[model samples]
Target chain A: MDYFIELFFSGLTRGSIYALIALGYTMVYGIIGLINFAHGEIYMIGAFTALIVSTVLTIYGFPLLAVIVLTALAAVIWAASYGYTIERLAYRPLRSAPRLSPLISAIGMSIFLQNYVLLAQTSDFQPFPALIPEFDFMEPYAHIVGSSDLAILVVSAIVMILLTFMIKFTRTGKAMRATAQDRKMAMLVGINVDNVISITFITGSALAAIGGLLIASHIGQINFYIGFIAGIKAFTAAVLGGIGSIPGAVLGSFILGLTEAFATGYVSSDYEDVFAFSLLVLILIFKPAGLLGKATVEKV
Target chain B: MIFSKRMLSILAAFALAAGIASNASAAETIKIGVAGAHSGDLASYGIPTMKAALLVAQDLNEQGGINGVKVEVLAEDDVCKPEVATNTATKLVSENVNVVIGHICSGATKAALPIYRDANIIVMSPSATNPDLTQSGDYPNFYRTIASDDAQARTLVDFATDTLKVGKIAVIHDKGDYGKGLAEFVKSFLEKDGKAEVVLFEGVTPGAVDYSAVVQKIRRSGADAVIYGGYHPEASKIVSQMRKKRMKTMFLAPDGVKDDTFINVTGKNAEGVYASGPADVSKNPLTKKFRDKFMATEGAEPGAFFDNGVTAALALTNAIAKAGTDSAAIAKVLHTETADTPFGAVKFDETGEPIGIGFVVYQVKDGKFVTVQ
Candidate 1:
């Protein structure tokens, strides 16, 4: 029980991060039908941004609280810009081309961004500051859930809740849904599909930036390659939850995270990845459209 | 048709003249090449080692050329890869450098050994510590300043029994050749010593986002301490995870986790963490002098391996000064003669492994590694 509960929290913490990143993948795929492979690199860039901003802000004598807030703002701002730019320059140009073209371009963009950051900063792992304050009261129960882990769970919950509310109640959310359902129909109905698609990217990237900040702080290190692994897991989460479904992405992430945690704890950590992938195959085989995904009819 | 007889003759004459002039210039300077991962995963280790070699070469040249021959340092980035190491060794052979200072990774050193052996180039690695490199007996020119991984394992095994005084322990490895081999070596040695029982010996997949399962197993086994044979990144995370679960089980870090990065990443969780490594020579006057100068000039610590690099460079330079450009003469001196290095007067056995290399145990205190034994 306590052991299983601990694993649950750990899984939940990891799942929330995966959900945050998966939302980016699902959203881009929802609005434009492109995988947005470079979305992972954007997350890495966000961590790097936070690293630099916090270091500089601390050197300039900003209080810890101020530095933390500014770092988050700086990371989201920069990552959002990168997301907007990538969609505009890479995906937008290939929107009307064969679907394969944008996919290849997304991969190319991913590589380009990885190397660019490698050259600009460094290839070595840079330690990220533990932005969350350590509460001595939590020390007694630190083994169950550390302060940073708690912060990750709380922040991600709030972000997810806000995202759910916005999508359900806002005009832009309706436009986004309309665009994802049928781009031609959405455009014909004066939805300004382009703006809606860009906004989707912005929101997705912002969420990913938060994920990057949270995970970097949680892991205590960030590097150019960290994003690649996190991105793959998040992409798997999106696929597992059903591509292009927001709630589905979060749900998939939690399932994957819990499975990984439980498998690692009960079986062997060596087989953890094996278990996760086998579960993915089993689920996909039976559900095909993913756990919460709707069946799509292709007009032949 | 483009090259008539007269044009061909003139071009050949110019080429012959240029070749002779370049040969004369090459004779005036002895070039030493440093090859390693100047970039990529192990760049943190390789880049600094190469930099220390270059600094030594510069300081040596400034003090007057070795044997009246000026020394020049050339560097090649092997990216800590064996294939790339072989490629870099071939490039260094083409450059006709007098000796080489790297292939700092064990895999890279092993892969490039044949090339250097065939080319008759001496490779003095500052940090490659795999026992197989020196034990293979196939390469006579290979040498390193640090003790082999087997030696490190032996030291840690002793520490586990004598220092920690733990009866039951669990040994874990990251499954890499270096980590797995060292962990197995330690497990075997511990068993042979008849002091403690290894409750669990298992391999964990590195780079997993979580390792709570491994921790749970270790906890259930009720091991007194966990000896991890791996690099710091994974070790730091593992230790942090254990501490997060509030397990105070002792964690022993090998040379791979002795660096500052481990402490920084683990932070407060690293308190009471024990680490093992070859004895520190940083306190020696000569090494301290170099470090002080390096710190003031370079704006960063040269790292633990840096002094070893300087020592390796000094040994090579001593051999070079004793024996001119003849690589065989240099190899003979390196094997038989004692060289005065910052690590103290160092001597190599027939296998080129340092004879008197030692290891120590350290504990992390207030975010710094303090020598415990």
Candidate 2:
């Protein structure tokens, strides 16, 4: 029973990270109808930014709390800027062009950003300093889950709730939804469709940045290539939950994470991906529109 | 446009003479191809070997060259991939390198060996430790300064059973050619030793963000120790996750995990982890000379395979100088003659396994890997 609980929490923690990154993919897909292939690179840049900031601050003898806050702030801001720039430079130009053009551009941007980071920094894995301190009251339960895991879960939950509230009640949120529904109609109604798309990209990049900071700290390492695999996994999660649906992305992430955990725990880590993808295949086969995805009729 | 048979024969003979002339001139500058992953993730391992080869060539040239002929280094990056290794090998061959120093990582070494053999270029690896490279009797030209994974696995299993006295062991691998190969050896050796019962043998996906599930499974298995077969990246992740989960099972791994990067990446979580690596011979004056030289030149401590690299460079140069450019003579010299390196006087056996070079288990204490007694 203890083992099962431990696995459950592990799954939740993993799911939270996936959800954070997948939200970016789903949101960008929702508003702009682009996969935003460079979303993962944004996450990687976030981790690298956090790593650099935290390392420098710690060297200068800053307080742990201040260092953590400053590092996360730096990561989010830098990643959000990169996201905005990428969408503007790569996607905006190809908006009226064929859809495949922007996708190919997105992929080229992904490769370009990866190489850019590689040249600017290094290909080596740098040790990410542990920022999350151990909670005193959680000592007894530390055996089941570390303090970092708890922090990740709580932080992700809060971020998700805040995002939900913003989307449900804010003006910018309504603009985003309107733009997502129909870019032409939103523009016709004076929605400033371009601004909504940029904001969506910024929001999604911020979430991915948060995910990168947490996961890098949790894993205790960061590299230029870390974004590629994380991006692929989160993209899978987004697709599994219906790429354009925000809630579906969250649901798919949890399901995927839990499936990976239980599979690795009960069976073997060798077949962990096998089970996760198999679940995705089964869901796609049965529902054809993902678990929470709504099948829409295309207008002629 | 085609030549007649008589004219072709004459042309072929003239071409052969020209080839012989070029070969003779090539001997004046003995080109040593340093092939390995010099630019990618495994660059840490390969770069040191390349640096060592370059330094050795410099030293030899400084000392009036090898047998009055200047030594040269031609480096080609394979990025530790097998497919690229074949290209690296062919490139080295076309460059007319007299000898090859490395194609680090066992898979790449295995891939490039046949190319070197076909070209009759003796290839010595600084770190490739797969047993089949030597034991398979497929490549007589292949030699390595490091001990094979089979030997490494035995050392690790022996330590786990005899030193640590762990009875139930869980073996895990990254499912790569090197990692899976080492894990299989560990599993078989453990079964044969009969001191430890193999509780769980599994492979984990490399580059997974989290390994908590595997950590949970390890805990539930009740294993006294976990033997891992992979590089530092995955090993650091597993060890960090296990410590975070408060699992006290001993973590043991092979040379792939025996890196300062592992300790750095894992930080405090790296404590008490055991890894088998090339036996330390730092006490040797030759070792000290190279160590100081590397530090002075590179401004950093020589990394994982620096010693092996020194040995390989010394051996190759020593062989070519002693036996001239004849491939057969070079092979015989490598077998019979010894090159005094960081590992003391080093010589290759008939099977191309180095004599005297072996593995030692090191435990991470505080923040560094300390050699275990």
Best by TM-score: 2
Model 2 alpha-carbon drift over 4 Å, by segment: B1-145, B281-283, B286-341, B345-355
- Candidate with top DockQ is 2
Predictions' DockQ, in order: 0.30, 0.60
For candidate 2, write residues A1-300 as lDDT tens digits.
Answer: 888998998898889888888988988987778988999999999999898889899999999999999999999999999999998999998999989999999999999999999999988788998888878988898878788888888887787688878888999999988987888999999998888888998999999889989989898998999999989998988889988888888889989999999999988889999999999999899988787777878999
Per-residue lDDT tens digits of candidate 1, residues B1-373? Answer: 6669889999999978876776687798988999988988788888777878877777888888897778999999999899889999998887777899988899999999899999888889988988889888888889888888798888888988997799999999998988898899989998899999998887787665556667767887889999999998889878977887789899986889998888887888889988887677767887887787688778988864888888888889888899887888998888788887778888788898876566888899998999997
For residues B1-373, write the lDDT of model 2, one tens digit per residue: 3568889999999978877886887967988899999998999999999989989889999998988889989999999999999999998887788899998989999999999999898999989977889999999999999888699888899999999999999999999988998889999999987999999999999999889888888888999999999999999999888887778899999989888888878888899999998776879998898889999988999898988999999998888888997889999999998888999888999999999798889999999889996
lDDT of 1 by residue, A1-300 (tens): 877887787688778878878888988887788898898999999989988898899899999999988999999999999998988999888989999999999999999999999999887777788888777988887877778878877876788788878777999988888888889999998999888988988888888888888888877788788878889999999999998887899899999988887886777666778888998999999988888778788999
Docking class of 1: acceptable
Q: What is the lDDT of residue A107 in candidate 2?
A: 95
Candidate 1: give the clashing pairs: none
Q: Which portions of model 1 show Cα errors greater than 4 Å?
A: A56-68, A135-140, B1-146, B280-342, B345-353
